[model samples]
Target: MNPYLIVPLLALFLNLSLFTYVLALKGKHRVVHLYLLYAGDLSLWIISIVLYWSFLPIHWMPWIFKISSISWLLAGTLFLEFVFAFLSKNPNILLYLLRGLALAIFPITLTTDWIIGGVERKYWGDMLLPGPLYVYGVNVLIVTPAVYAIFLLLYESRKEEIGFRKQCYLLAFGTFLTSILGFLTTILPRILSQGDLHYPPLSGSASVIQSLCVFIAIAKYGFLEIRLEKIALQLYSKLREGVILLSTADELLYWNESAKEILGFSKSSSAPEKLDLGNFLDGFTRKPFTRMDFKKKSESPAKEIRIDDETIYSTGPVYLEVSKSEIPISGRDLGKVYVLRDITEKKEASEKINMLYSRVVRDLDIAREVQNTITTRTFPDSEKFKIFSYFRPYDHVGGDVLNCAESVDGKIEILFADVSGHGISSAMVAAMASISFNVVSRKGSKPKEGLLFTNDLLSSVVTQHFISAMYLRFDPKTLILEYSYAGHHAGLLLRKGETLDLPGKGGVLLAVGTPILEDYQIQLQAGDRILLYSDGLFEVRGSKGIPMGNTTLVEAVKKLSYQDSDGLIRSLVSYSESFGDGIMTDDLTLFCLEISESA
Candidate 1:
């Protein structure tokens, strides 16, 4: 076989491969029009190769070669068609009719021998050679559209987003050189009569270069867009994020692209063992990130990432939201992509905000200590009454306070008050309420008189206002229970299996109305329990606009019949939790007292 047969065979394969690739990218790149252009060019080369290779069998070689010249016109026309498609240029019906007229000239020349030389059987072989006028006629047909296509490509390249157009220019230049050289190789020798001016030097070299370019463009280069894999490689070299990508089972694959560049590894080399993705990432001894909090296949809000001195502040999806895609060549699940973006500045800002919060918390701690000193825990105990108290605050400062003191006359006064609101202001009111209880009780005042006096004192002294309270005094010898309410929720008394609700029917809260309270007396038994609590306990909102009212309290107390004071209080909280579906909106303070036998 002639060595020249290699060029045509390579061109045939190049054209076929590109055509198939265009089909493969069918809906994706919309490159079907490119396929038609290359196919026509391949038909031209095939006919030319066969005519030259089998010149000795001249029975049909001349006719076939003559016919093959028309294929170049089709190829050139489609190249222009693709150029217009790329430039987003739409032509009218008249312009397309003019193109059809240009294409007809190729067919007319082929049949008439105006496009190629006459057939001759010389000593070399039977060669349907080109005539003197062949080069001039062929140039006119091929050069017009090919030159126009080049102009269109160059014009489009000047536009803003002309990445694909720029590539098209490279492609057109390669094909243009090959096609012009191919025509010259066939016609130049017959016209000059001195030497063949095309093949070997011009056409052969151009064909080889064109074939290599088409192979590269179709196989390696993406559809004119930069792919994520390429971007990943660039970030690996440039950014500071210590990215270590892992498979779903946590097997490491890729690591710091930046680290490798820093350590002097070429972009093509793998990461070093010391910097191997798995070993290096595992050596990062900080607390592991919580996977539960991460969104799957979605982005995250800005968050802090402190990885050693690097401090990669991530603002986007910390991991690549990779969906599974099947590689057509390999029927396997390719691993997911994990993209990480650094937001170091935003992370530092958050750290500063947290530091400021810590400073404020420290100041609040000092205030809490001073508040504790204002209220002493040395209240006198009573033998006739056993007190069980539970105080819990949602915040640093609670709104609930309870005080009990023994009088000189063997009477015991118990006071429970829930200050208005919560936090710092409420803590101050609680301190005042405790101080007032101690002073009034030391003055030997009765429960009603003491409460009225305390209310009056606070109303005048305190800035923003009043307090709700229930004050009670029990005398063992007289067997009388005296209690008064000042704008507070009533107390609950449990005797045997029955429960009683004590209504406040008296004065308003402190600082609001006159210091007058109704006094209620009830006989107590040894086994009876009385529970005092803030409105936080029963005034909780329940279903259908009803508060957990008196009726619910009665049922709760009866259910805790066998329990002691502490146990009964726990049961009430548990039952109330069940009543409100485990969500309580206010602070709960319960003080339980059991009636005991006189010593």
Candidate 2:
């Protein structure tokens, strides 16, 4: 068995296998199928070359070379036809007729030494060259068709798919180089070496290498149908959101991986019959579809489907959309391909984003806790100083700090400070100031001394944005009430049927870097009473659009002096609320202390 004969037979088998694989591949284009068929012709030529060079006998050599050469010519002609079919609207008949003519010339050359002339036998092998009309005719037939094939390939590659064109060009260039090298290295060298020359045979490996490289290029780049179609199919299957494809027969043709996960379907195939699709999606409360008969040519392709009462935990119904399109078949309508995309997550996210402020409802609950800690919690013993306090914060939280405590001298110290700003941040500062007030009062300082201490601490600790307050201390035994102001509104003192705005010029507010110099003293008699309040209680604007100034506050206190401390705070709140037209913008806090020997 000759090695060359066996190699050609094997190469022919491999080539046929590749061509068959191309036909088996599923794709949309007929031109692609034609190109693969042409490539098969080239494979046949390569195999024929192997068989011809196997050196049977002298009598068979010329006939074998003639047939193999004719096969090569047909392969090159097919290559051009493939390109013309791919690039142009139709095949060029003139080129086809010329290719037929070239084939006809092969038989004529065989009979007479007209085309290939005669084969001359040498020691190594036999060589075929042109003679007479066939001498230039062979060159014309081969080179003319080859040049045309090259040009057609160039033009087709430009018009075809980007990746496909690249692969085709790669295959064409590699084939050209290999064919040139095969002829030069084997045939030309053997002829030029004259009779005694023996050149190493150019192995069938050149065509094999070229074929494999082109096959790889085709598999990786040219034949994209399998890869792209697989991706499309997989995406339709695996999407977690519901997906449904409705075909021409009003039938469900496809579903995706996630369609089942979200839409509550089992592993039963994604495609449901049209009736089944309706049944599966029946529970949804959505706008009526125009008809259950899936329209192949619908004016609109997308619509939202709403599902109500889906689950107990859901905030509301879930919404989904079906995107539909007509799947175009060459002569047949494949109905509408519909995709069901569950947009439940997107809807939920959008709703959550819209009501972002709802989180503040939770914060309001926290604000209530802060109010409890800052207000009544500061002084637990209401029994000690006959202390009566009313604190009402306007918003969820406001800037108000109130204090009541017994000093070392048996005097009751009380004050209300208003910090600037609002919301949680201001409320926080107010809480801190409340704690500071209690701490300083327990330090056993006079009303003024405590005020100075608090002011100093607040000045260091708080921001300049806050306002300081008034502190009042009443000594029951001494009948002396002392007060200190830190940039606070005046404290009202009512005596002898006249309104007295006790003069209070104070140091800068606490937490503000201002000098601590202002303190005032007052004589407390048996019938005199004092009002300690946040500015919110007095400076509040009335319906008449006037702040309830010191004069009006003094008058209100005069009438309320006879009431107990609790009654006094209530009366003041009522009065302030009425004056402000029932609008409380700031936190209102008040503590009233009346001097009575009977208590």
Candidate 3:
């Protein structure tokens, strides 16, 4: 088998595989499917050059060259079509002109030796020269459009996503390299070496290399489908937050329009390799330009520069948050990234985010040992009752709170209060309520009296929010439980294998300063179980986003009342999570108290 014949056969198989593979991997987009047509035609051109130039008889070789060259002509046309569509451009005039020119010269080139002509025999094989119509056929139809496609790749890459633009850059370089190698093999070797080298015969592999580079871009990075909208270029540059990308040596490689505007650069100014950080020091007035100065100012956070003077965007001093991070890892240093955020617009929101960030760090350490935190448990000195409770907020601080007081008299006061909302503000109100309840209890007031005094305290302090509460006083000797609710869910009681709601007279929500209605009473017996919970328990959303109602809560309490208080709370939490598909939408609080006959 001739080595030349084997190379063409391999190229034929590779292009065939590429055509089918590109079509199959269309990813529901038709851009690459059209490019496959080019690959198919190139495949045919490779096979045609072998048969017409080498394998065929001398009599048929000249005419066969003209006909076989049509596939190569179509291959170039299809490649240009692919480029236009890939860039989301309409190819109306130039594309049609190329096609028409190729069709018009096809018959003339086949009969007369005006296009391909008779090839000159070179070192290994025959070399075909561009004949009389080479300018119209090859230059106008093929070479011009191929060069234009490289420029199109570069232009489109600027508006693409960062990672994808990088892929496009590599792909464009491959296209350029393939074109250079093809030129070197065909036109360069022919002009420089004369009839010494058969460069034209070996040029088939360059097309295959081009196709492989294109296929890699398509299959690996999804270059065809994932191009960013071109409008984003203007928007990215026009964003209020300034973005600057610098090299390892603190040279500015790229900066957005906002950065240029903030840095006092005119719109017409071009990028400089080394930006003066000394000039930036005046903008960042608080900290010195040195890293040692930054370390002395703040140890943890990257400092923000406050731009107080009137500028383009704001009339008041704009507080711009400065954030710097290392760019994505590469062998070549892409430098560090610096971002400036306008935190002046919403001072409250910025403060809240900072406060939340601080609380998150503080709570992480506090949560590690929450043994004596907000949800601490205590039992009355009586052996008749055993109580266990659980509380967990969505954040570090919570509105749900519980306080147990063993009164000087033969009374045990248990108060469970839920502020109207979650977070720091609500927690503060809950804390205030807890303190008032303790103060009222110390004065030897009844559960109703303490609740009334607490409501008045809430109305004075809490604004734009309210509290829901249940105050209970239990007499272990008499087995009497008296409770009063202020806009709270009724307590649940499990007695004699049935669940019962301890419906109590309800008053207005506490922070409104309304007087409590008459308290409700329930006589406790042996084997009686009582549950006090925040609405967050039953308000848990399921997979369908529907809240678990009180009916579900009653059933859960009745079924799991046999377990100890800790086990019961844990089991109920587990059950709620099972219904919710493990998504926690709100805080949870559950308190279980069981009466034992043996005790």
The candidate maximizing TM-score is: 3
TM for candidate 3 is 0.40
lDDT of each: 0.58, 0.59, 0.65
TM-scores for every candidate against the unseen true structure: 0.39, 0.36, 0.40
- What's the ranking of the predictions by lDDT, best on top? 3, 2, 1
Error of 1 at 354 (Å): 1.6
Q: What is the descending TM-score order?
A: 3, 1, 2
Clashing pairs in 1: 117-130, 117-131, 236-257, 236-258, 313-343, 320-338, 320-339
How many clashing residue pairs appear in each of the predictions shown?
Answer: 7, 15, 0
lDDT of 3 by residue, 244-338 (tens): 76656665545787887665678777666566544553344423222211111112233342212312121234344566676532322345666
Q: Candidate 1, TM-score vs. the true structure?
A: 0.39
Instruction: Tell me model 1's lDDT, rounded to 2 decimals.
Output: 0.58
Query: How well does candidate 3 score on lDDT at residue 64?
Result: 67
lDDT-wise, the better of 1 and 3 is 3
- Candidate with best lDDT: 3
